[model samples]
Target: ENKAMESRLRQAGFPYVRTLEDFDFAFQAAISKRHIQQLTTMQWIDDAFNVFFLGPPGTGKTHLSVAIGGAAVDKGYKVRFISMDQLVSAFRTESTDPKAHRALRAIRKADLVIIDELGFLPITRTEANQFFQLVNDLYQRTSIIITSNKSFEEW
Candidate 1:
């Protein structure tokens, strides 16, 4: 079990490790601790529900998403953490890049995917189409958690 967890954590691709216990709820008082506790249960992932964390930069969006993703990994779910830029880049070169192809394949097989830093960069039409197709394919199959600094209207 330890080895499996180590492998899963390594495969999850988190920039760094962060756990719920390390989160400063008092600093981000707007977030409800109880609600976050509920999320740590990971029932939403099991239901293939998508989670969105939208706020200005440095409001703990990535931190919360990473914490929840870490929890998911600990629970034995396959998880993948990719920045939005990285994902878009992978989509752009997936056809010719073996590394990108492998990354996409790993994402598809993950039970929970954490996409951080959405809306940080503008994407071309081709990239948008590729992203749409990937999301459509993951729909109803894998759960996704996205962290974006932009509002829903802006997106």
Candidate 2:
């Protein structure tokens, strides 16, 4: 009975959710009255922000990333979910052709981008630059959620 009730409550607030616990922590962290008061007083507003979820595996990094993306989608923002491998593979495949530019534009135009599994394998210098370019393009234009298993030193 308790589980069913919780499910209904989550569905009421988040209709398109894949998992009810996805935004659990973020919602809690953001809704605290103390933090809300502090945020209201802040003057500077940036065009975009990067959220890095650095932790060991099975720590809900990707889950929270997806949840944030879902919230953005619900609010009418364009969102994209691409793993590091997929992004690099696609970029490399288009590297020698005119389509490379188009691939970059897609990443740039997204309002929210969820990049999962960073530092999964060794990346070549060329691949690293391509990743950096994508990051640069979205630096101040769109929000980014990056999930990484490795520590900052590895990056």
Candidate 3:
């Protein structure tokens, strides 16, 4: 079981390991501790509900997303973590690149997908469409956790 967990963690592609216990709720007073605790139960993922962590830079959005994703992985759910840039690149090359296609396939298969650092870079119109398409494809089939520095209006 331990070996399986280690393999799942590796396949999840988390940039760093973080747990709900490691999060300092005192630092981010705006966040609801109770809500986070509820999320740790993984009920939202089971419902295939999408979660968005939107805030300015250094507000612990990525931290929270990663922590939740880690919790999901520990609960025997398949998880995948990727930056917005990386996801865009994969979408751009998925047609010509077999590796990108496989990556997208893996992402689609995951129970939870964490897209971090959105709005850190600008993408072209075509890329935006591709992103929309991917999101549409994953809709209802997979749960998504997105961490973005931009506000909903800006996005």
Candidate 4:
């Protein structure tokens, strides 16, 4: 049992992996120092960090995001994966005031929430506000991994 715990911790990567020998520098470039710093801090207390991956199509955004989330899960984090469309759709379906709040609460409960394919479709103003609220709720509290085909300026 002790060895199992140690093995899981080693699989978490990060401090266990001394160098980025296996990580792609290109993917590393996509990630910002602030996010890395936040992750480092989170390592201290089992907290999580928020990260955004924005670039053109086929830029390996999804791959890197998944890798990070996988690493977090290996480290024993409760990770939730969903596309932006799914998030919007889920909230749109339960347009009731109470259900919307419930969805928001669900998002807040995750240790890591990953949203992929953002900006794939046009979002209504209200949806945008709700999405922003979700972001704000998770901001600094839990980790978020966002991947988008559009550049930051376009977003």
Candidate 5:
């Protein structure tokens, strides 16, 4: 059972395997290790609360988000990690296409999804609408960890 679970996690398509232990709190002093530890417990996921990691480049926002998502996966929850570009590309590829449906279905089924680099790419208003639709669909049903370089005010 343990082996199978490991295999499942391996195939879950994490951007990269990042763990809380691997994160360098010394380098990123602004981030609170205690907060990260609390997040690792994934209580937010149980309550379907979204986690937003907003910081400038090289601040380790991605590291924290991935670490948290990895924690969820380790606890036997399904997780999917993708960049903002990949998400927009998937949505812009033809709304009724099989690929789009597959992406939506995958997000729907995941217990936690890590959307990394959420403002790195330029998306059209239409694509933004579609993305919001996905967010709306997942609201209160699945948890998401969003890593963005932009602040909430910018968003």
Candidate 6:
């Protein structure tokens, strides 16, 4: 398990380390303290459901996602974190590139995938379709945590 955990963290691609203890809940009153607290349990990951964090900048979206995903990693779940821009960039090459398949396969094997920063930039129609395919493939099979500046309506 220790060896496997080391591999998992290598693939997790966390921007920087953060934990539940590192977060300041008192300062972010817009977020539901109870809800975030419950999320740290990582039960939703077990159920293969999705989690979304939506708000403007400096609202702790990335912090909360990293914290929750880090919690799951501590519990030995295969977790991966990637920005939407990076995923989209990968999707553009998936059809012809073996490296792209390898990257996508890594995401497939993970138990929890945290996709951060959707809607940070506008995506073309083709890119949007590719992203949809990725989402569809992962849906109901693994947990996905999406952090977006826009709402579902915008997506």
Indicate which candidate wins on TM-score: 1
Total clashes, candidate 2? 0
RMSD of each: 0.8, 8.6, 1.0, 6.7, 1.6, 1.4
Residues 1-155, candidate 6, lDDT per residue (tens digit)? 88787777777989998887888888888888899889978889889999999999898999999998888888999898989988888788877998877888889888999999999989999899888888888888899999999998988
Ranking by TM-score: 1, 3, 6, 5, 2, 4
Instruction: Write candidate 2's Cα lDDT for 75-148 as tens digits.
Output: 45566777888778878877576665565566678766778899987789999998998898787778777889
Q: Largest lDDT belongs to which candidate?
A: 1
Q: What local distance difference test score does each model get?
A: 0.92, 0.65, 0.91, 0.66, 0.83, 0.88
lDDT of 3 by residue, 47-97 (tens): 999999998898888889989988888899999999999999999899999
Predicted structure 5: lDDT: 0.83
Candidates 3 and 4 compared: the better one by TM-score is 3
Off by over 4 Å in 5: 94-100
Q: Candidate 6: which stretches are off by over 4 Å?
A: none
Q: Estimate each model's TM-score.
A: 0.97, 0.69, 0.96, 0.67, 0.92, 0.93
For residues 89-117, could you state the per-residue lDDT of candidate 1 as single tens digits?
89878899999999999999999999998
Error of 2 at 16 (Å): 11
Candidate 4 global CA lDDT score: 0.66
| Candidate 4 residue spans exceeding 4 A from truth | 1-48, 95-104
In candidate 5, residue 129 scores what lDDT? Answer: 96
Question: Candidate 4 versus the native: TM-score?
Answer: 0.67
* Residue 118's lDDT in candidate 1: 82
What lDDT score is found at residue 107 in candidate 3? 92
Cα distance off (Å), candidate 4, residue 27: 9.6
* lDDT at residue 3 of model 6 (Cα atoms): 79
